[model samples]
Every structure is written in C-alpha cells, then in structure tokens.
Target: MSRPPRILDGGTGTGLQEAGIAIAEPWLTSAALRDEAGVAALLGVHTGFLRSGSDVLTANTFRTNTRALARMGVAEADRPGYVRRAVDCAVAARAAAGTPHALVAASVAPVEDCYTPSLTPDDDALRREHRWMAGVLADSETDLVLVETQCTRREAVIAVEAAVERGLTAWVSFVVTGAAQLPDGDSLREAARACVEAGAAAVSANCFPHAAVPRALDQLGGLGAAVGVYPNLEDRAALDEWEHSAHSLPPALTPEAFAGLARRWSAEYELAFVGGCCGTGPAHIGALAGLPVGAAS
Candidate 1:
C-alpha cells in the first residue's frame, strides 16, 4: 500500500495548557525561563501527540523571536540562545516520543506585533531578523523551517529568502480572514505566488477562522506549488465577537465539525497537507485520521 499523505500539527504553545502547563503571556514567558515547569509540561504534550501519530512537530519557538524577546526585556545578545533553547525543547520531546520518522519544523513567527501588517518591520530590518532566526534554526537538527502567521507579502519574502539562503526546505503559511485576504488586504493568491517566487517548498494558510478555510483553499489552486491548511475552531459567539472587534474572522467548530472541514481539503489539492491550527488538539486530529487518505471529510 502507498503511504498516507502527511498532516502538519499546529499550535504547540497553547496546546501545552491541555497538558497541564499554563502558557500565560506566551510572549513574555517564552523569553524568560521563568516557566521551567511549563516548558517541561509543554514538551510532554508534544511527546503525546507524536506518540499519537502526528506527522510533524513544530518547535516551541513561535514567540521566542528576537523582536518578541526584546519586548520582554531580554537583551539582544541573549535572544539567539532563547531560540536555540526552544528548538532543543522540541528536539528532546520528539526524541522521547521514540518516533524516528517524525519531522521537526523550526517555527518562525511574526514579530512582536501581529494582526497589523502595517507594524511589520521595514525590509532591511525584517530581512535581518528573518535571516538571524532562520540561520539559527537551520543549524539545529530540525528537518524544515516553517514561516507561519505571516500577514504581509513583504515579510513572507524575507522568510523565504532566509530559508533559501540557508538551503533549508521551507514552508510559508499565511494567516487570513473570511475574504481570503491578508490583514494588509493583499490577496492570498498574491502571497502564495510571492512565496513560490522566493523559493518556498510550500504555501499554506494557517490560524485563520474555520469559515474562511474552504475559500482560502479554493484561492490556492494552480499555484504550481504545494499547498496546505491548518485551521482553528472557535465558538460561534467568540467568532462573531472577534470578527467584529478585530475585523478578523474566527475558527469555531467541534472536533468532528473541523474534521469534516479538513476532509474537504484532502480531495481538492493534490499537493496538500491538512491539519489543525488554533483550538484544534488531539481530538481534532483523531477525527481527521478516520477519513480516507485523500478524502477531505
């Protein structure tokens, strides 16, 4: 029998909470080692998921970027060490799971501010930060690097370039809303092309509200590159409120509901990889596992 296609797992930092670790102020806590117990607890959660059959594990470096570390008062010189530490945590957890075939992705996240593409650092600075982070991640045992939650095509370019420069396989994932538009109002298709032009191994949408995923995937067609999706589940009330307040959509669905949603993607994109994002945990993944290898839902 042919091997089943891969499904990428998402959101390990918050998933730590489910494993009995409180990842409060993830931005702040990720900088300092104050939450040592939390770190261990979080690592255990990742181990559980790996054992449960996740194809990919993202390192706990989402909020450990230099910009985020600087926000938490970490000295500039110490930021690289924090990133290294985060990568080590994921590596150790994956090793403990005894899943030799599991893939580890070094996660590079948005700078300090998110949801405001306008606040992104300028080209030179953005490139500098991305280069620094991607370079560090490349030196580790990580199998690949994921540039996630990017809201601007410009920022996406910097990340893709960094990945190519280091000769690491990279995936560029966007965070979008109902209309398949990035926070800066750039179309997802444009962003997808930008990543491809910059030499990304794949283009994906992540952390978007559930309702927007299908449309987002529809928009990804014919990009001549691999595409992926990992959406979160938000409650209806929470989704509506967040959309109105932040002008961003919410992803709200039960694990089964999300599985149905995820199942759709498998049939549509041949080069597709599907999984969970925010609000998705082991149950969501379990539901998806029941579907046929390429069945969407």
Candidate 2:
C-alpha cells in the first residue's frame, strides 16, 4: 500500500442541498437537470470536490434511475434522459476542473429506502432494477458504477452482478445498523464477500454514521479487495431519511476532526478511498487531504 489513497469526493445530494438547491424527494437529482442553472450547480459541486483534492467525481445520478424517479411520477421512457443528464453534469465538472485525471462515477442507489430492510424488494425485482440502472450507467462515459448505501446482502449481490454483467467495474457499499452489522443483522464480512464474489472490485461503506466507521474498517480490512468509506459527520438514530441539518448541528465533528478519523482508518486499513457523506462538504475533503498518506498496515 505504498501508493497514496484515491481521495473520492464527498456526498453529492447532501452537498447540493448545502449549496441551496431546492431538492424534492423521489425525483432527487432528476429535478436538478431541467435547466442550465441546475446543471451548473451540479458541475460546481463536482469541481469543488476536485479543487479539494478528490480523484474521483461521482455523478449526481444517485436518484435519477427509473425505479427511484418512478416514485416522483417520472415516466420510464424519460428516465434514461435524466441519468444521461446527471452523468453529463459530472463530466462537465471534471472538464471544467481541468483535471484530466479526475474520473466520473455513476452512482447506483438502492431501489428501496436504504435504511428500511423490511422494504427490500424480492430478488427478481432487485435484479431487474439494478440491471436497468447499471445498463444505463455502463453506456455512459462513467469510469465505474458504485452501488452505495446498500443495506441487504441480497441487494448487494444483485447490484454487483448487474454492474459486472454490463462490463463495468462495480463497488458495493453497505449501510450498517447501529450494531455494526447489515440492517438485517447479517455479518458485514459475509456481505462484502458476497458482493466480491459477484464481481465487485471493492467493498466499502457510505452514508454510515460517523461512529460506525471503526467497525466498518475492521470488517472491510482483510477482505482481499479495495476498501473505502465515506461516512456521515454526525450520529443519527436512523437512516430512513437524510436530513439536511448540518448547519444546526453546531459543535459536531469539524472538518479537521473528520479528517483525523479518516487518517486513522487510512493508516489501519490502507483504505483505497476516503471522503465524507451526509454533512460532509469540500472543507472536509480539504482537511482529509492534508493528512499523511495511507498505507495498508
């Protein structure tokens, strides 16, 4: 692990909200692609992360898939347009950042709410939905597809399979429960292995509570694959919804403090990736980059 870690960007939707985008649920990133101003905002966020030293810029397609946008009454035929727009925005951002090395990633979010395990659909449905999303993403210029905030092993496997089937590099990240296990109480180690077996190139976690990261690193380490993390900055009782409450949560972990935590994991796990999630902004990434380089200790 002599190489420096790849500094992935922080949260996109949460970052967008912090940037003053009036985002409504269901449609999510789709609503942001309807105009030039909105597209500029998306590009601005990506460039901000790049300026902060991010090596990868995840596209704002976290909620642009047919299954998610369907909840907002977006027609099936129009979903591809939204996905394309989201990817294009991130691509534009990388171009504008003038960092030829920055890579764009198409994000694949859970078909159901990430926190509610009971709401996870059947395997067939998960396969179909994930494949549909991955198909569109693979056709784009994105360098990879990240299935982030996954809660169940079934869904992780399904998502990974879809991305691999499309010949795209996949990363499957799980959202753990308070007990540091998958939402269904399954071992995170097992989940990571399952995803890897399904062709995921990386096993990681994102949108996890800040405190759960230690346990996540313990599990992600020794998995024989690239490990990474991008955790929320505060402790929340549930992940049912991503509440945009960073401004009010004063005295919470500052960017420097978050960077220290990332430094710890990067040292211990030799993390392949590190960044922020909910409540994390470019400042967090800047602080993280200031730390010493990572090693697979």
Candidate 3:
C-alpha cells in the first residue's frame, strides 16, 4: 500500500508575525532567537503545529546565513550561535510537544531575496554560502536540509549539492512565476530534474498562489523523487503577483477550505506531503491532520 502523505508545518515566519513577534527584515524569524520571550513564542508555534499533527517542523534559519547576518550588522563571530539557536528552538519544541519522530529541517534559503532572481549572487557566492550554511545544519544535527523558495535552478542545485555533500538529506523547493515556470523564467521541470540529479531526495513547488500548484505538480511528476507543495494563501486572482498583501485582504481559504484543497491535491497528485506557506496557521494544519490517512487514491 502507498504511504500516507506527511504533513509539513505551516509558515514559520508569518506565524511568528501573527503571534505578535516583531520579525524585521535582514533577520526575519531568526530574530526571534534574541530573547527568552521570543524563544518561548517560537516554541509555542512549533508545539502548536506538532499538536496539529505536522510531521516536519522547519527551523527558523531562513536568514541566518552570513550574507543576511552581515546585512543585519551581526558580527561574524556570533553568526553560528544564531543558526544553532534556531535549530535548538525547533528541537526543544519537538521535545516539548512529545513527538520524537517529527523531523526538524533547517531552512536553507537563497543568499538574496527569494523573489528577485536578478539579485542572485554569482556562482561562486552561491556555492560558498550554501556550503557554509549546509555545514552548519549538519553540525547542528538537523534531521534534514530544506533548500526552499529558490528562484533559480543554479542556486537550488548548488544548495542541494552542499547539503548532500555534508551527508544531509536535502529537499529542494522552488517559487514559480506561473505553472511549470520558475520565477527566473526557467522551466520548473528542468530545475526539479537538476536538483534531483544533484542528490535532492524530494522536489517541491512552494510559496506560489494556490491556483498554480496543480500545474506545477503536473510538471514535477515522473521525476523519480517524492513531490510536494506548500502554496501561500493567495487566491487565483493573485496568480501573477509575487508580493503578498495578506494583511490588507482576507485569506483566500478558510482552514476547512484549505484542508479540502489539500485532500484533493493529495488524491490527485499522490503528493508525498501537503502543507501551507504564508498566511497559514495551526488551525489549517489541524484540519489537514483530521483528514483520513491513505486518503490518496
């Protein structure tokens, strides 16, 4: 029998912001590691997702890389500590939630803005930065490395290769401009294939509007690797929009509606996992967990 899909947790940075945490640019969710209250809030967010039956809890290391930290004015000496703290919060939250089997994935984002492919660093910078970030995740004992929201194929390949070189199980995810198209206008099929060839155990399309996921998944099929999606809570009308204005508009789907869509995606695509991106919360995950296992058919 086919295995049930794993439920990845919803948006970490957005969830933190919803929880009243001040996550500024250059630090993002990583800034939540600065104090006891922030740490407690982080743990609460993780435990909430765990209670909602998430199988994977991604650490808030999205902006802990050297390039991001340098922009935040953090000294080189204190950078690793920030990354470790992000991992530690996830580990501690897993322990607190009493779920020993849930995986803690380190978030390996692009060296620059995830949406602006033109701002991507040179090939050397990509390799060097991803190598350093992957080394830290391995050293921190992350359950896996999630190279997510990559706008370019080269960055995804380099990041996946770096994680695999450190003996980490890496899953790479991309952001798309449209169905089967990367934000940089590359074919998603080609990018997914490249990452798979570079040692990615899974390939996914993420952080795009919900309407685009099915077509993206269609292109992702037959890659010989597990496929998944975690789309942002944007409606079909926002398909061409990259920037999220979630605060100004109501959510595109209620928790129940989101769960219903996830069920359809799971059954139709045989998705290895289904989860949310921006604007999702524990309630959305809880709804997903309530769906019958092996619902895919």
Candidate 4:
C-alpha cells in the first residue's frame, strides 16, 4: 500500500462553537485564550484532530494580532501576548497527543473581516501588521505558517512576503466566491501569481463554498507550485443571531462527503494537502485520514 495522505486539522472557531463554547466578539480567535474553558476547548479541538490523524495542526492565532484585537479594544502592548498564549495552546495540545509526526502550523488570517476584502487596509498597514504577526509566529516554534482566507491580491502578496521573510515555509490560501473569483473580484490566478511571486511554498483554496473547490483546483492545478484545498463545509452551527440566518445557511457537507471530495481532488488534480475549513470538526478530518490510497491512474 502507498503511504497515507497527510491531513490537516479542521475548522477551530466553528468546532469550538459547536461544542458550546461562545465568545461575543465578531472575531473570536484570541478571545478564547482569555477564557479558561475556551483555552481547554481549543486544546481539546487540537488534540482531537491530532488523534484523528492530522499531520499538521494549525495554531489559533488568527485574531491575535494587534490590528485585529485593537478593534475589539485590545491594547497594542498586550496583543502579542495573546498570540503567545494561542501558540502555547497548540503546543500543549500537540504534546498531549504525543504525535511526533504531527507538525504545528501558525494560522495567519486576514486583518480585516474575512468576509470583506475591501476592508483590507492600505499597503502600509498591511505590511506593518502582517510582518509583526508573522514574526511572532516564527518565534512560536511553529513548523510552517499558513496565511489563510486571504481575499485581496495586495494583502496576499504582503502576507506571503511576511511569512517568507521569517525563514519559514508558507502557504497562502485564498477564499473565493461561488464564481471562483476572490472577494474583491480578482481572478484566483492573479492571487496565486502574487503569492508565488512572494515565494510562498504553496497556494491553496480555503474557507469558501465547497462547490467552488473544483473550479479553484482547476485554476490552481499546474501552477508550478504545490496546491491544496480545505474548503468550508456548509451547515455551520448557529453561533449568534447575527451569524445564523437563512442567508448564511448552506447545505451541510458531512464528513463522508468531504472525504470523498478530498479523495477525488487528490486522485485527479494532484492535491498536495487536504483538510477542512469552517463547519468541520475532528470527525471530518478522521474521515479524510481514513481514505484508502488507490493505485495511480
């Protein structure tokens, strides 16, 4: 039998939400570090994915940067501390799992609302903030830095540069709309080009409509760099009144369905990595890990 495909962890925020952990912020990444149960919940989620056979476990540093928490009234002086705490959570979780083969990846999310790329700051702020966060993660002992859910070409370029500057392997992932264009309506090819120009080790599609995966893979395939996908599962749990509504609801992509999709991508398009985004949990990742490797076509 061929070696098993490596799997990445599933969605953290949504997994926490589904587990009855709640924080009242629009961006709840680092806030969970403040709550003891939240930290434990995050650790549990990380350990869960590890036990489920994830090769790479992403740290929960998405909203830990100064610019993002500054919006939630977190002081600039205290922001980086939260990032350290987030890293500690991931490290602790990995150690608890005792999986030496699993590597910890620091998650670098967009500074602005992931749903709105237009809100991405100007070049100056983008460079300043992303560099700061990437530096923090590099110091956190993470194996790789994943700059995910990016939308704009400019930010993607800056983010990938920041990651590469820290001497860490990086993958810049874009979130696309149903039409397979980025949130700002730029072509995915342009975004991939920008990341590659910045020296990203890989380019990926993430946190978008599952139906958008194949189109994105088609666009990203044969781009001369490693390609990956970890698209969002539909049927997200209701976190709050504002986040839960008919408009936001989409069909649920269960773990089995997700595994099958990943298998297809791996077989046909030469996917370098496979995992989940929002609405997925360890169960989803377990299903992915359980896929049997087939003979090459």
Measured against the true structure, the TM-scores of the candidates, in listed sequence, are: 0.87, 0.91, 0.93, 0.90
What ranking emerges by TM-score with the best candidate at the front? 3, 2, 4, 1
Residue pairs with backbone overlap in model 4:
none
Compared with the true structure, what per-residue lDDT tens digits does model 4 show for residues 1-297? 144446889878776766666644655656578778888888888888888878898999888877878877877788888888888888898889988778888888888877677688999999999999988888887888888888788888898898899898988899888788887789998789778878988889898778778899888866678888888786655543114322223438767788888888888777778888876677778778883323100
**Model 2 has how many clashing residue pairs?**
0
Q: Over all chains combined, what TM-score does candidate 3 have?
A: 0.93
Instruction: Give the residue spans of candidate 2 off by over 4 A.
Output: 235-251, 291-297
Best by TM-score: 3
* Cα lDDT of model 2 by residue, 1-297, tens digit: 688788889767666676677666645555667778888777888888887778888988888767777887778898898889988888888888787888888888888778788899999898888888888887899999988988889888998999999899998888886567887888999999988888999989887677778888888877678999887765454424445442323224777788888888888889888887766677778778783333100
| Alpha-carbon runs more than 4 Å astray in model 3 | 234-240, 244-250, 291-297
lDDT string, candidate 3, 1-297, tens digits: 198799999878777787788666656777688788888888888888887889899998988898999888989988888899999999998899888999999999999989999999999999999898987888895899999999999999999999999999999999986565987789999999999999999999888878888889989989989999999874536444765443323458888889999989999999988899877777888889894433221
How good is model 1 by TM-score? Answer: 0.87
**Clashing residue pairs in candidate 2, if any?**
none
